[model samples]
Target: MEFENRDEYIIKKYQQDEETMIQLYVQWCSNHQIDPIALYQRAYPGQVQNESLLKAVEEKDQESIEISSDTLLEVLQMFGNDDLAFAVTEEIQKRSKR
Candidate 1:
């Protein structure tokens, strides 16, 4: 692969990784029969639509990926999405109590 600039290459790699993260999140939500968008809204009330998330959901492919709660939380935190991770944690706790 050839890149005109190192910055451009870095940015492209980051975007691709971010896309994979989003797709994983979406797949996790589907596995648990949860609405990813609604969960996101609860985490970020009054915020506008998350374009990346929406796009991920819309373009999601049917893949049977088993995502654990802990794994999802860690991934969200890795992406600096503490709010969303909190929401996911709450959901996990709620499910456990049921």
Candidate 2:
């Protein structure tokens, strides 16, 4: 995931291979019938060591990285999470407009 200044190819490769993680996330969220947008807000407990996505935001950080438009569709497809992608896009848009 979040290698600082890494090659684009490497990031995509990782995203493709470990995509099951996101798939699992989608399935779980769907089963819970939870608002996907709400999931973005609940604080994750403890230090989560996500080997992929390569970076984790601290509990206090509100701004997430802009998922590049070129890779946006790929990310949506990879996780079967259009809602999450849209939510992220909305945040990015709101921040940009600010």
Best by TM-score: 1
Backbone-clash count (model 1) = 0
**lDDT tens digits, residue span 1-98, model 2:** 55554778778877666554444433333443433334444322243534432322122124333334436546565656565556656654665697
lDDT of 2 at 22: 48
* Deviation of model 2 at 18, angstroms: 3.4
Give a tens-digit lDDT track for model 1, residues 1-98: 36568878899998898888788889988998899999999999989999999999998888687988888888889989899899888888888899
Count of backbone clashes, every candidate in sequence: 0, 2
**Candidate 2 ranges with C-alpha deviation above 4 Å:** 1-16, 19-67
Top of the candidates by lDDT: 1
Model 1: CA > 4 A from native: 1-4
State how far residue 43 of model 2 sits from its true place (Å).
13
